[model samples]
Structures are given as structure tokens and as C-alpha cells.
Target: MNNILNIVKHIEKSIIFILIVFLVAILVVSVVDFGLYFSRLLFYSSLEGWYEPEFLMPLFSSFLIVLIGIELLETIKAYLKDDSIHVELVILVAIIALARKIIVLDYSTMKPEKLYGLAGLILSLSVAYFLIKSAGISMKLRKKSSVDQK
Candidate 1:
């Protein structure tokens, strides 16, 4: 039984290592693409170029995607190190993804129901993140106080 468990654990780590390699490749490509796009955009007439929603929205979305990728990489690294998932990091990644969606969304064409759903999701994730953060802080404080009193 212990040998089987060890094999399973080794398999899991191998898969995770592969995933990390793929993710790194993707992030590198994304960063290069973003840089090329940004440089191209810079050549367009000054403030007018920056103000174009068509150009700006995609740029913002790409930037956020790269950020999300970086955050995910951190989460994966943390998991590998600690053998546990961090809820706070995952929530932050979700929030970043949502922000990216909002950035690229065409609000004028969006249905009211869809908008409401997004709002609800955002609120729920925000509340959950807050609660987790608060709990962690309180736990740390309690530990510190107990140690001090001893």
C-alpha cells in the first residue's frame, strides 16, 4: 500500500512538472506577443492611439492574461513546495481573470442578466478572499500571543 501511494505521488509530481514547463513556455510566448503589440501601438499618433478602445482593450486583456499566468505559476510552485493549495492565491487569480473579462467586454451589447451574474461572482469572490485573509491573520496573531504568554 505504501509503495502504491509513493508511485501515485511520483506520478503526480511528474505531471505537475510537465504542466509547469508548458506554462512557462506559454508565458514566454505571451510576453513576447504583448511586447510586439505594444511596440506597434506606440507608433500610432500619440493620445489618439492610446484612447482607441479597439486597441486598448486587447492590450489590457493581454496584460491581465500574463498577470494571471504569473499568479497561477506562483500557486503551482506553492502547491509543489507545501503539498497544499492556497485558496487566497486561487481567489486572486480568479479576480484577475474577471477583471480581464470586464476589460474586454462590450458592455453595450451585454445582457442585464449576464452583467448581474458577473457582479454576483465578483462580490462572492471578494467576500471569500476577505474572510480567508482575516482568518489567516487572526490565526497568526493567536499563535504569537500564545507563544508570548508562555
Candidate 2:
């Protein structure tokens, strides 16, 4: 048991180190990509009949910034060992991912059953709300138990 515990600790330390390194790499890559994309947008803006990138480029880059923010938050949550993450974040991520899919896919070609799947996703979010409240109750009970034990 002690050996297993030691091994697990070592693995966790290694993983945290790797995560830090990878996060730095991601930040560097994101900066480089943004610079490249912004340069291209500037170059392409002068062409005739080219889509107006003034609005599009900023919107795209802003979305990329939001994505990086989300990733950074996730990394921090992991590093802090916050085992009880906010349930709303999970629901929000699910809703965003599904909404993106529903927006991008050709709705006309989608099957009737796929509509039901979207409804299911909504139902799952509702369930997640219940869990969020239940988790609060759980914490309260845990506190009570610990106080009683003391």
C-alpha cells in the first residue's frame, strides 16, 4: 500500500510538471498563431471582393482568447487539486460543444433522431443542475459529520 501511494505521488508530480510545460508551449503557440493570422488578415484586407476581415478577424481572435482562458482555468483547477469542481462548468462546456455542432452541421440533412439527441442534452443539463444543488447539500452534511466527530 505504501509503495502504491509513493508511486501515485510520483506520477502526480510528474503530471503537474508536464502540464506546466505544456501550458507554456500552448501559450507560445497561441501567440505565434495569432500573429500569423493577424498578419494575413491585414495582407488580405486590400484585395477586391475579399470578405471584410475587420469584424471577422477580431471575432475569431476574441473567441481564441476565450478558449485560452478556459484552458488556463482548467489547468489551475487541476493544479489546485480541487476535486469538487463547479458542476455548472461541466454543463456549460457540454452546452457550448453541442451548440457548436448544431450550428455547424447541415440541419437540413440531419436525421429526426438527432433532434431528440439535442433534447437529451438539454435534459442532461437539467440533471446537472440537480447535482449542483445536491453537492451543496452533501457539503453541508459533510461539515456536520466532521463537527460531530470532533
Candidate 3:
């Protein structure tokens, strides 16, 4: 039984390692893509001799994509460190993704109701993140107090 458990544990670790490698590869590609996209935007703007307001959304979106990728990498790192995924980090990633959408969204193209829906979604995620964070803090405090009593 112990040997079987050890084998299972090894398999799990291998899978996680594989995932991390793939994620790192993806992160590297994302960084390169971000740089290329940003540089192209700047180069074109320089050639045109002036920046355009239309480019603002794309620029912000690209930046946010890189930021989201970094956050995801952090989540994987945290998981590796603790052997568990953190809910707060996941929620943060979700929030960042939503923000990215908002940044790139064409308000004129979207309906008013859709915008309201996004607003509500953001609010819900924010509340959930807060609750999860507070719960984690309370759990740590409880653990500490229990240890002290013991």
C-alpha cells in the first residue's frame, strides 16, 4: 500500500511538473508577443507621427494580457509551494481577466445591458475575493490560537 501511494504521489508530482513547464513556455511566448505587439504599436505611431486614441484600448489590452499571464504563473507557483491552489489567487486572475475585457471592450458596440452585466460580474468577483481572503486570515488566526492553547 505504501509503495502504491508513493507511486501515485510521484505521478502527481510529474504531472504538476509537466504543467509548470508548459505554463512557463506559454508565459515566455506571451511576454515575447506582448513586447512585439507593443513595439509594433509604437513603431507605427512613430511613423504616423502621432498616437491615435483608437490604439489605446489595444495597448491596454495587451498589457493586461501580460499581467494576467504573470498572475496565472504566480498561481501555479503558489500551488507548487503549498500543494494546494489558493482561491484568492484564482479569483484575482478572474478579476484581472474581467478588467482586461473591460479595457478592450467597445462600449459603443456593446449594449447598455451587457455593460451592466459586466459591472455586476465584477462586483460579485470582488465580493467573493474579499470573503475568501478574510476566511483565509481567520483560518490562520484560529490555527495560531489553537496552537497557543495547546
Best by lDDT: 1
Off by over 4 Å in 3: 47-51, 134-150
Q: Order the candidate numbers by TM-score, best to worst.
A: 1, 3, 2
Error of model 2, residue 46, in angstroms = 7.1
> What TM-score would each prediction reach against the true structure?
0.86, 0.54, 0.78
* lDDT (10s digit) by residue, model 3, range 65-132: 87898888888777666666777788899999999998778787899999999999999999988997
C-alpha lDDT of all candidate models, in order: 0.83, 0.60, 0.77
Off by over 4 Å in 1: 44-47, 137-150
Q: Which residue pairs collide, candidate 2?
A: none
lDDT of 2 by residue, 1-150 (tens): 656766766686687777777767776777777777767766865656445554454546545564654656564455446434444555555655565555445567889898898879878876876777677743211112222344
Candidate number with greatest TM-score: 1
Tens-place lDDT per residue, model 1, 1-150, is: 656766777797899999999999999999999998888788653656577798689789889989999999998887777666777888999999998898899999999999999999999999988998987642111112222344
Candidate 1: what lDDT? 0.83
Residues forming the 10-long window of minimal summed lDDT in candidate 3: 138-147
- State the weakest 10-residue window (summed lDDT) of model 1: 138-147
